[model samples]
Target: MPFTVYEHGAVAGWDVARPLRPGRSAGISLAGFRYRSAGSADLPVIPHPAVTVVVEFGDGSLVMGDASGWQQRGSLVAGLVPGAVRVRGENVTCVEVHVSPVVAHAVLGICPAELDRTVVALDDLWGRDAARLREQLGDAPSWEDRFTLTDALFSHRRGTGPPADPEVVRAWDRIIVSRGSVRVEDLAAEVGWSRRRLWSRFRSQVGLPPKRATTLVRFRHAAHRLTAGDSTARVAAECGYADQSHLHRETLAFTGVTPAALAADPGLAVDDIAWASTAPTETA
Candidate 1:
């Protein structure tokens, strides 16, 4: 697997796909680089961000959007925020872009309110500006230009820098090492802090509470296993769930689909799980 830098910025470095597995994606970050779906391969939707960039190619290509609770299909290349969807095959090849919260903060320096949520498409906010952006950025544009475009599109939503709380980082690190099972109290003690302090900082930097963040990370791990054809019972046990049902309930809550449904569809089940140094988002 050859890794290439797709883009770079003060916040991160985006690298191109180096096939983590047969149908999985490994780490590839150069902050704020946009990704279009590959036209040759059809992909299944997994638990993912509300806003993402997708493209299609070949016949029988379908993309499903799990907006809120509704799942629908179409050429949903523009709007993908914090939702899950299934992408049907039409010989479509898809590539997903990863955005940094810090870069988003840089873009929206003063208006912290805009940072409250996620943006699905550049055109959604810019309208005609989206076309102009595509036109300026041909098949492959300079990394600097890509970062600039991303920054400009998200500029109005930036806020204060991520929290300076060491406890938050410590807790996040614990979850990563534990594969998402460290107790909040245990983490607090390790950092010599209280649970309340840990929560405050975790929420500030990651925009989700420690418990929820832990759950999300755990779900992502399970999704990876399920997509890779691991049985629900096995995944549940490995992820610290009480049982398969426990894992099923949590997966459905975040993904709106059962483990069986996900595993049944190879594209969605075995797609890439984007694990980042900061935040992780699962993509197909």
Candidate 2:
């Protein structure tokens, strides 16, 4: 697979290394990135449905926190952060994996809802194994090798953990296919479960409750469109928002930026080159 490199905006040296193909795991994908700058730089941690994992090997430290301040972290395994979080660092190199919430339980060994609105260090979750993997990745000769190793690691662990209920998986697929346009009641009806039952099961297994998850999915679709240079009116109308103001409020809630501002963001400008879809490898 070939790597498509991209710039990191105003940062002195910002580059993204996209994988040639997707990972073998369901709803999992990887992207390798390297950034260096004399001055510190920040990247927005916009709200999204996927739980993000970032394993870094670089001289500069990465901080994950809000507008107040940040705390040091080795490797980031982040779940549904409600507000804006920025990752600030210099001279960073990492392989980032995005795991859809549907498979997050099996892949990350916990419901994303448990870790929602927070970032946790990999060492805390995976223990010493996390450190060993970091060392191995740092020693790897190329980005492809690092990605392969990382993919293999996640695949190995995924098999050991319990899988989400099949019905919940189906429901999640439905939500994605509709781009969050489907109603939770309709999802429950399709799965042969009552609305309350689906809510309890989905909240326990996938992460957020049905309604919250739906909103996030809808907003994320709009965020991508905005990042892709789509007009606010179009994104709003197309993404299921009632009106432009509806889009504006939700955008601020998820990204803390207005539609036009979020659209103009430079970090998101490189998504086409770096971001892989949450869809799995075999099907995709």
Estimate the Cα RMSD of every predicted model relative to the unseen true structure.
8.9, 4.2
* Shift of residue 150 alpha carbon in model 2, Å: 0.2
For the record, the alpha-carbon RMSD of candidate 1 to the native fold, in angstroms, is 8.9
Native-referenced Cα lDDT, model 2:
0.78
Q: What TM-score would each prediction reach against the true structure?
A: 0.59, 0.90
lDDT of 1 at 284: 33
What does the lDDT read for residue 283 in candidate 2?
12
The runs of at least 3 residues in candidate 1 whose Cα sits more than 4 Å from the true structure, single-residue gaps closed, are 1-45, 48-64, 67-81, 84-95, 100-119, 123-133, 141-166, 273-284
Supply the global lDDT for candidate 1.
Answer: 0.48
For candidate 2, the 10 contiguous residues with the lowest summed lDDT are 3-12
lDDT of 2 at 89: 79
